[model samples]
Target: MTTNPTLVLGGTGKTGRRVAHRLADLDVPVRLGSRAGTPPFDWTDPAGWDPVLAGVGAVYLTYQPDLAAPGGAEVVAAFARRAAAHDVRRIVLLSGRGEPEAEHAEAAVRAAGVPCTVLRASWFQQNFSESHLVDPVRAGVVALPVGDVPEPFVDADDIADVAVAALSGDGHAGQLYELTGPRALTFAEAVAGIAAATGRDVRFTTVTTEAYAARLAAEGVPNAVAGLLTYLFTEVLDGRNAHVADGVEQVLGRPARDFAGYAAATAVTGVWKP
Candidate 1:
């Protein structure tokens, strides 16, 4: 039988995947909580959840899509209740900074009668390196609705480190870490960094939110996802999240990773090449 296992939701996604790897490296038994796991866990299917939560002691909850979406808070609350019923002791929730809806979800986790830590993160640097923006970088141009508003894009590695620390170690409960890179940069500046590192000529183009949404729709992205992206760029990416936070240092006792470092390292992998 599996030992005292820590369940990692969204276990194949950006941060959760890294967290899982870090935990496994530390020789911790981990239960990957996703639709593809042994006992599948699907957010859309409540029946699929209990099986994964069974016998789990700790949880690293990374909500799919985002916690700011409709019904996200409720879903998290319900999941936390089930986790508590299953005797899970700790929960490390991956959250978004400056998102009111995300705050609601955090509160639900905190009130779940279990030890909870919220890793409230800004935009992820991996969003460019490993995500949708990778193609745009490889294509030599990244088009978005964001303007001069700078974002302190956090590295997913830093997020994963913090998450693993919280999930496996003590003294992290009831903490909320706002993880971000050490510097803030605009999309244009971020592209410039990637270009410098990869020896590529990547460009950034700004557009209206409507135009960005229209572009996503044309790409066959679901209307909800397209709208969420547009809302994130237009509403969340505003100057509200421009400043850098020390939550990473507060949690990890070290400075957060910088964006240039991420760019330099990812550049060596040739992931941005055309």
Candidate 2:
């Protein structure tokens, strides 16, 4: 049994927190691997890695911002090496689909010589409720550069469940799971669904990628983050991630959650209420 406390990097984020909670519920000791965690694991500080890795048997890695971001693969490789040096045997990485950089990061994690499971997830359903779009949804307008191209937005809960299973159970090592919702929906359709669920007049506005990037800059968002979004909206969303995957069902013997279900559930929480 992999009974020791598993370290959950990005533990305060949506999927990470859910994984930590699920692990704790199973009576597994759960360590939040963040700068705020005991021994203080900071990705920006290489010196902090050893303290959190000590005595850890498994790790759930959710890179900040994105695994496809600049220099992300190198950082992942370094951290995986440190974990292997500390004798940590299991690793579950939260990754993205249709991303070349994400693939590179995955390879780096495997090169650490530890048994690993990769969850290459689609766009998250929680982006509307828990991330940048919350304010826009609440304000009744979600403007972005994405349009027409459909995405099967996977629920964070499914990702977390799969991560928990991979972390605690056998037979998941060397697995690569592509997790997505059962169906794809365009951004406008998604916003309409949210509006139906929340009884709001939320509108989805499509803008040019350049205009979106300029808006982000005007709003004082970091250039790196803005660039990531621009890349996602303009380049990555071009029908590459349009299909659904059964990774959640394959891993957990259960179907992945759908986007409408997510919006309906989130609606009841008043998160989209103005």
Candidate 3:
């Protein structure tokens, strides 16, 4: 296989880590783009751009925080320009499904003239075991501000496989993949699923966005982060994305992993043990 280094930005993150591992397993030269990576890269630091972009042919772009966050377009545009100038051929962006700002960011990458593939993934199933929900689940109460919105939470494993194919070949350029699981479930339903999988009493509690934000603030989370979380739960999870998408099938020629599958597998890790 002819190859050049593929940089996996946010290599320590959910999908990025999986992407990096998949690429490595395929014998692709993978450069991890993180603050602690060799020749570290930072989204906010322009001077560090050259070191990371140098000699890298393709990039798996996972923005810090998210593309829906403020200034996401500008940063994506800037990095795309740098990547283009450095002869980077392919840019696969991990974007948000149904987010306007995320689409704008994808445009920024395309505008730079590099072949780009947008993986617009829905809520991740790993967010429970891998993110803030872990402690809550172990504590037996997973409280959140979301109501009956049913999200088709996609698995990072499927995302990584599609990303690996996109990064290694020419088949997926300029394609926007809406990556979601085959079934949608409300937060409460998801919690129940996890509870059943882990054999524990992990409950889900719904709260107002304002109250959730206030709780976050009381926990020492910065105001900006708190507001962003509130905006995400209140504005984005408003039932617009309560359906399944076939991007995974389109790209991988296989069905996407279901949330129940994710819950079953993650339960084996004992992350929810208390």
Query: Cα-based RMSD of the predictions, in order?
Result: 1.4, 0.9, 1.0
Clashing pairs in 1: none
Name the candidate, 2 or 3, with the larger lDDT value: 2
TM-scores of the models, in the given order? 0.97, 0.98, 0.98
Residues 1-274, model 1: lDDT tens digits = 2368999998999998999999999889999998899898899999888889888989999987889888889999999998999999999999998899999999998888889999999999999978879888999989999889999999999999999989988898988888889999999999999999988789999987778888788889898787778778888987999889999898789999999999999999888889
**lDDT score for residue 244 of model 2:** 88
Question: Local distance difference test, per candidate?
Answer: 0.90, 0.93, 0.91
Candidate 2 at 84: error in angstroms?
0.5
lDDT of 2 by residue, 108-137 (tens): 999999999999999999999999789889
Candidate 3, 151-242: lDDT as tens digits: 99999899999999899877789898999999999999999999999988889999877788878988898876777778778889999899
What ranking of all candidate models by TM-score puts the best one first?
2, 3, 1
Q: Model 1 compared with the native: what TM-score?
A: 0.97
* Alpha carbon RMSD to native, model 3: 1.0
Sorted on lDDT, best first, the list reads 2, 3, 1
- Name the regions of candidate 3 deviating beyond 4 angstroms: none
